[model samples]
Target: MHVQKHFGKQGILLVNLGTPDEPTPRAVNRYLGEFLTDPRVIDNLPGPAQQLLVRGIIAPIRSGIVNPFKPGGSTKLYQELWTENGSPLKYYGEILTEAVAKEMGDDFIVRLAMRYQNPSIADALKELMDAEVSSITIFPLFPQYASATTGSVHQEVMRLLSKEQIIPNVNMVNSYYEHPDLIRVFADNARDLGPMDQWDHIIFSYHGLPQRQLKKGDRSGCHCYADGTNACCSSISRVNQFCYSAQCHATTRAIVAELGLSEGSYTTSFQSRLGFDDWAKPYTIDVLEDLAKNKGAKKLLCFSPAFVADCLETTIEIGLEYQEEFEEWGGEHIQLVPSLNGDPRWIAAVVEMLREEVGSNVVL
Candidate 1:
């Protein structure tokens, strides 16, 4: 390791879950091939099984190269999510990075990297390293903590830095599920939708992870997969602090508190579960169905707190497909609260968090 004693300028790396370079099937295929292959993403599966699933099933179906098992057209969804600029995820990420770079001026070098795909963590780190930044802080854009997302970014950062002869003072943010300003931005987005009473029910849906992943991550073996009991899995304790399910619950609680929503008015669920394996309980689809059918809910508001920017999961999945699902269940509307993509408050929160982690003197 290159051990440099005196510090130069602080380097800030803004990392987000990646997007395909283009919205085509080929692009989507390469993206999934890289993303799903990461051990952090498919942690529980055996290496051979993981490769088999990715190469034989997921990638081929996504790219439309294999026809026997035709999965839904990901390219169409990507087309819907694509804007004048490009993928919403990457577009907003670039805008956010530019905003932060301008805010910090030249003293701090702010670079954006996708955990997978173009502008990857490795290339971005190499850029920072070339700049000879004496210290570095990694800010994974995920609000809630999960090994698959934030943990993966940190793992890649360390793995690359480990090969270097000289290493700078490195720091990484684990999670900011309940950061005050972040909560404010999300809540404010809800508030912008007029009165809370307008909607019959509200749902905070976070990206899902397999329950097995939760169990694997649980250092306190007893704390995870407690049959969805609020006592054990709801509260963030010393034992289950890093649990993705628990933090999702915590984020819901915080945003609801900010909105002054009553206990029964809103609930939390997990989304984007794949395969037959059980994932974080109370799936978003189930919650939406129940709301539309049994609960007599007409209009519903959905918030995806896990994503900082509106992406495929947020825009096409929840906003479009979930809306269709809700309508099929006789629901009037299901409005998705927009993500905190380029919101100034969200940017301010990022700066604040960086300042807190680095020091008070960070030029923001």
Candidate 2:
């Protein structure tokens, strides 16, 4: 009698936040309908209230469904962000998926999915299941751990996997906010814009989360909302280990250190706050105001570290919108640092991270 060995390819699923399929109002409406309704994304409201608010008011108004005569504010921004190939979020995701697949060679199969749009997580998971991979590693593209982001992706993945009869060994990456390769990529991108000393100031802007959501994520009950100052979020600790704000601060520190930026030269702030509710404080707009009006700072460089790819937020909001505002506030130039889109170095870094994950797991 003779026995044969079995070998199987590992599955790698990369999930981004999401993007509208198209730049039109109706498309954005559809996209926001799915995205804003996620309980994790809008955890402050009850399910029924969340549904009603999002469907009845937020989505429709933002997408111009309520008043068709005037185009929604988001519609114009998406139009500006759109390219010949469509949404940069999805396009870059596709490019990344293909690059990772090729780099991993025959040993791995990589798939890309968006949490709330086309190329959904369901279809991507189905493909991996169909391939009968020995093990599955879910790598959410979000660098920081936020219940609304990495947490939501993990929950969705588990929900989808729960229906399968035979589940392979599953592993999910929580966050890589301080990954050396990730930090280096950001620093290198900044360096490419000539010398860093020319800029008067730098801003590290992460997407804002509601303050209520931040408090809700804190299970220890001793931090987050304990103080009104939010000084607790100044550094990472076991008490607030999973806090998004803390992770953002840590990420900024890492990038600043890598770039050899001195203290007081850079500031960390949050952007893209939705609704009137209180969000992470020291908002990016306020920071911009202080830098220009009070400090008389000009020629600022901004880094949106929370987002790995350039989307509406980075390109339109920071690049165009902020630039216009900064100029009005007596600033000379507000240079937007490029994101790690399809750069070969970024591709290599992602491959290295995936290999590390795969190597640590047991195959079949």
TM-score of each: 0.94, 0.95
State the lDDT at 32 in candidate 2.
Answer: 92
TM-score of 2: 0.95
Cα lDDT, model 1, residue 194: 94
**Candidate 1 lDDT for residue 192:** 92
Clashing pairs in 2: none
- The residue-by-residue lDDT of candidate 2 on 179-243, one tens digit each, is 99999999999999988889999999999999988888788877886868678877888888899
Tens digit per residue, CA lDDT, model 1, 1-364: 3334536677999999998898777778888888999989988779999988997798878766564244338766787889998888888898899988888877789999999998899999999999999889999999878888999999999999999999988888899999888899999999999999999999998899988888887786776765555456668889988878888888888888898999899988888888899887789999999988998899999999999998989998999899999999999898899898888888888887887876633432
lDDT of 1 at 251: 88
TM-score, model 1 to reference: 0.94
- Model 1 misplaced stretches (Cα beyond 4 Å): 1-6, 66-72, 227-230, 360-364
Give the Å shift of residue 141 in candidate 2. Answer: 1.0
